[model samples]
Target chain A: MEKAGWDGFEIGAMLRTFDGAIQNIATTLPEDRAYSQSSSFTASVADWRIEKPLFNKDYCIDCQFCWVFCPDMSIISRDKKMIGIDFDHCKGCGICVEVCPTNPKSLLMFPEQKDEESALVEWPKKVKKEKEDEVGEE
Target chain B: MSEIKKIKNLKEFSTSADRFEGANLLCPGCAHSIIVREVLNATNDDLILAASTGCLEVCTAVYPYTSWDASWIHIGFENGSTAVAGAEAMYKALKTKGRLKQPDRVPKFVAFGGDGATYDIGFQWISGCFERGHNMMYVCLDNEVYANTGGQRSSSTPIGASATTTPAGSVSYGEKKNKKDMVAIMAAHGAPYVAQVAPNKWKDMVAKIQKGFAAEGPVFINAMSACTTEWKFAPEDTIAISDLATDSLVFPLYEIINGTELNITYRPKNIIPVRDYLGAQGRFKHLFKKEYSYLIDEWQTRVDAKWEQLQRREEARV
Candidate 1:
C-alpha cells in the first residue's frame, strides 16, 4: 500500500474537520476576544461602568450561573475553578449579583467608585485623549 | 382617532403609588413599562417576582430606585427559572411551615427577563421549571436582541436583522440565522398556558397577563417589545413601531393554550408588507438593498407560512 500523499479528498476532509474544530473553539471562545481579529475594539463611556458581581466566594457552589448568563460574555473561568470578571466587557449591570443563588448571595453589586480603573488596557486613543482633556479642564 | 380610544376612567385606572414606582428600570417607551403596568394592575396579591438581569433589571434595580411594586428579587439573567423556582420552593416551604402570612392563597411568583436571558441563557432553567410544574408566569420581553449590552444579537434576533455582533458590513451578512422558535419550544414543554402579545396593544397585553397568572402550572409570555436604543429609532416612535409590527403581521398577537389550541387575538384590518415593518427600523436597513433583499423575502415567506399555519390551527379548533 502506497503511503497517501495530500490528495484532494483527504485534504478536503482534513480541511472540513479543521473548520469544524475551529468553529467549536470559536463558539467556546469569549465573544469579545472571538471577534477581536476582525473588529477593532472601540472603548465607549459605558465601559467605565462598575458592573462586577459581588461574589462571596464562600457561598459559590461553582454552578457557573454568572459565567453562563453574562450577556457581554465577560466572565472567565480560571484554572483554579474560580470565576473572574473581564471588566473590559462587563457593563457592570449587576446581573451576577442578582443571579447568585448562594445563601448569603455569593455575588453582589459594588457601588461605583472613582478609584477603580477599568481592566481594558487598550482604552481607545480618542476616548483617552477626551478623558485627559476633561481632567485638564477640571 | 376612532381606532385609538382614550382609556376611560383614568382615576380608576390609576395604579398603586407604592408599587412599581422605584422598582422598574426601563427606558422611556420601553415595553417593560407596559408589562410591569399589566402585572401590577392585574393582581394586588403579595407576589414574589424573580427578575432576570437585562435592561429591565438594570434600569429598575439600579442602586436604591426600585420600580418593582411587589416583592421583587433581582436574579441573574440565566437563572430566572431557577431563582423563581427557588422563590416558589421557599414560598411553598414557608406556607407549609406556617411562616407565610397567607397560607391558603399562595403568593404569585412571576419571572421576568429579556430575550437574551429567556430564550438563550435561561432556556435550560426555564425548561426545568416547566418540567417540574412550577406555579409561575415566565415573562420574556422579546426585544429580539441583547439590548442592554449595546444591542448584541441574541438567539431571538430575527433573520436579516443587524446587531452589534451581526453588523451588516462588507465582511459579513446580517444575522444569517432564523430566530429560535421560543414559543414552540415552550409549547413543546407542555406548558399549560403560552401567549405572545405586543406591548403596544395595552388591553390585550393586560388581559393576557391576567389570564397567565390565573393558570395553574407554568405560563410563558413572549412579549414583543420595542427597543428604541437597540433599534436605533426615535424614542417617540416606540409605540408607532410596535403598532406597525402587528399591522404588518411581522408579529401576530395571539395566545396558545395547553400547547395545542391557537387563538389569534387581533388580526390587522389590512395586512401590510413586511417591508413596511422592516423600513420602520434601522436594524433592518441592509435588507432594502439587492443582495439581502432575497433573504428578507425568504424571511417574510417564513413569517407568512407561520401565520398561515396558526390560522389553520385556529380554524381546525372552530
Candidate 2:
C-alpha cells in the first residue's frame, strides 16, 4: 500500500561540490525519505507491475525464499514471521515466483489484470480454496 | 577479522528494513539491486553510503527522487571512495571532538560503484584510500561491463564476452584481455579484509560483508553482479546464471584476511565447464559457435588456472 499523507519534514543539509571540493561541511540531519520521495514511490510506477505473485499460503511452508529473493523487498516479514507480498510496491519482478522452491509453488507469477478478483488487492482475503480452484488447478 | 555474524536462515535475513527502501528504477532483473540489498542487510546500524555516478546512482537518485533509505552521497564518476573518505573523516573528527550528537553509534561508511568505476576510472582514488588506510569499505558490484553507459567494455569484462565497444562480429572476440584481478590487487594493498563474492551465494556473501564491516582497517569486496538486459538473459535466470558462474568456477567465493590468510568459501562439488555459464548469456553467445569452440577452451583454461591458484593460496594459509 502507498503510505501516503505528507509529513512535511524539512529537507536536510546537502553536500555540494564546487571545483572538486566538498563545501558546507556540517553535522547535517539524517534524511527522512518523506521529504523528497515516498519511500514507497514504487507505488507511483504501478504500471511497472506487469505481473503479480499469486501466493498459496496453504502450500507456503514459509521457506522465506520469496522474501529473500525479492529485490524490491516488497515481501513483508515481521519479527521473523513471513507475511504476504505488498503488491503496491512489488514491481512484479517475479523473482519470488522463480525462487519459490516448493513442489506446488507457494508463489507463482500471473499477468496483472485490472479485475480485482485476479489482482492482489484481495490477496489477504482470497482463501486457499479459491486460489486452488483458480491458480493451483494447473 | 570480526566474528562472522552467521545468518541462521533466510527468515532472519529478511527481517531488516530493505536498505534500498526508495523505489529504484534499476532494470527488472538487475543483479546490482540484489547486491545492494545484501550490502544493506549486512549491517543494521545507521549507514552513510557514497556512490559513484553509475547505474546505482543514476537509477536510484534522480533529483527529488531517491531509492536509498540511508544517508547517501554521490560525488563524481571517479570519486565514490573519495567522497566517503571525506565523510568518514569528518564523522570521526566530530565524534573525537565531542561535537557529534551520537558518538556512541557512529554510522558505518560504505562506498559502492560499478566495475567501470572500481576497476578503471576510480582505481586511483580507491588505491589512495587503501594506502591512506581509511576506515571504510569499498564494494565493487562488478557486472563485467559499463552496463549503465551503453554496455561499454570495462577492465573487469571477461575475455570473449561481447560488449558495445568490443563487438564480436567477424574478427573481434569481444574483450581481449583477462578481467583485472581486482581481488588480488586489493589484497596487495595490505587490506585487512579483501573478498570476492557472488551475489547469489547469500550465506557466504552476508558473512563476507559482516567480516568486512568488522575489519579494523580498509576492506574490499568484489561482488560479481549479473546484468540481465546487457547480458541478454531472461529475468528469471538472474540467480541461476550467477549460481552457474560460481559452480563453473568462473566466479569463486573466497576471502583474504590481512592479505595473507586466504579462505575459499565454496568449492563446487563438481566444477562444471565455463560453457554452461557462457552459453546462457547472449553476450557470450558468439563463443558457442563451432568455430568459437577454441574460445571456450581458452576461457575454461583461464578459469581452471585461477581456481588452482586460489586453491594453492588457501592451502598455503594453513
Candidate 3:
C-alpha cells in the first residue's frame, strides 16, 4: 500500500490496489487448459471470425444500434456516433451489419482478409433478393 | 435530486474501466455478453459484482483474469444471491465504521447467474436474498437451458424444445412442462423491483436496471439470454431471434413494481405466430415433423392464452 500510496478506501473497494497475492502469483497453473496470467494483455479473438463488418461512414445514420448490440464492444463509438469496428477483439459475427437500420446498411460484411476501404468499394447499394432462376444461371 | 447519469453519449464513459469488455472466451454473438455490459453500465457508482458458476462466470472471469472491470468475484452456482447479500451488509457495516470517506460512493451490489443457476439450482438462495430485504440486485441471464455444461433442460426451457437431457425421440416428445414464470416467482417475494428484459431491447434493459438500482431493497431482473450455441442458430442471428421471441410473445418484456402492479413494457405491432418462432430454432425441429405438427398448434394456443392472461393482468394493474 505504501509503495503505490493506496488509501484504505481503495483497498476496501478493491478498485485499484495490488496486494502481495496478486504480485506473486502461483507458478504452477492448471496444465490442461490454455491460460494466461491475470491482467495480462488479453489475446484478440479476431481469428475466430470468417467475415468482418466494414463500416461505411457515408451510409451510416449513426442510429447507435450497432454500438448497443455489439457483444464484444467492438463497435468503436465517439460522441455517441459509431466510427469503426475494433478488429483487435472483434470475432466478426456480422451483428453490426444485421442490426444496422439503414436501407443500404451502414455496416457491410466482407471476407475477413479484405480491408475496409476495399470492402467498401464492393458494398451493395441495395441487396436484391435474387430469384432461384438467376441463382441457377451461375 | 440530480438524475442518474444516463449513457446518452458513449464517449463520456471510459470503455475499458467502466463496463465489462472483451478478451474472454464467450462465443462470438452471445446475447448475455451484451446484457452483461448493459447491466454493468447502468450503475454509475463503483460495483462489487458476483457471478455464479455458469456461462458468464466460467467464460468471463477465469480465476484472476476477468473481462468485468468492476470488483468481481466468482462464486458458486447457488451463491449469487446469498453472496451479494453479505457484500451489501459489509458495505453497510463499513459505512457505520467510517471506513468509506465518500458518502455518495455507494458501490452497487449485483450478482449475475444463468438460467440453470437462477431458475433452478440457486433459486432457494435467491429467494432468501429477497426475503432478507438485502439491498442488492440479482440478474438472471435466462438462456432456458444449462448451456454451460452442454444444454440440458432447465425449468426455464420452453416446452417441446429438445435438450440434451430431454431429447426428442420417436416415442418421447421434448420438454413436457411449460417454462417456469421466473419473473412472477421473483415478484412473489415482494421485492421492491422485478422485471423481465432482453438484450435486443437495449434501452428497456438499461432503464429496467436503472430502476432496479433505484429501488430500496432486493431487485430481481430476468433478462432473456439468446444462446446461439444451444438454441441452434447462427451467431449473428442472436438479436433477430430475441426480437422474434418478444414479437411472438414467447418471452414478453414486462415489469412488476413493488411485487404487485404489472406493466407491459414492449408489445409487438402485429403478433407473429408462435410457429415461426418454434420453427426458427433447431431445438424445436422435431415439432415441425408431420406426426408432431399438432404440438406447434398446441403451443400457439398456450402462447395466446398466456398473452391474454398477461394483458388481463396489465389491464387490472395487479
Q: How high is the CA lDDT of each candidate model?
A: 0.65, 0.78, 0.78
What is the C-alpha RMSD, rounded to one decimal, of candidate 2?
6.6
How many clashes (backbone atoms < 3 Å, residues ≥3 apart in a chain or on different chains) does model 2 have? Answer: 0
CA shift of B73, model 3, Å:
0.7
Q: Candidate 1: TM-score?
A: 0.66
lDDT ranking, high to low: 3, 2, 1
lDDT by residue (B204-236, candidate 2, tens digit) is 898888888988878999999888888888776
True-structure lDDT of candidate 3: 0.78
Off by over 4 Å in 1: A1-138, B1-12, B15-18, B22-25
DockQ of each: 0.01, 0.23, 0.22
How do the candidates rank by DockQ, highest first? 2, 3, 1
At residue B185, candidate 3 shows an lDDT of 94
**Ten consecutive residues with minimal summed lDDT in candidate 2 chain B?**
B1-10
Stretches > 4 Å off in candidate 3: A1-37, A126-138, B1-3, B7-18
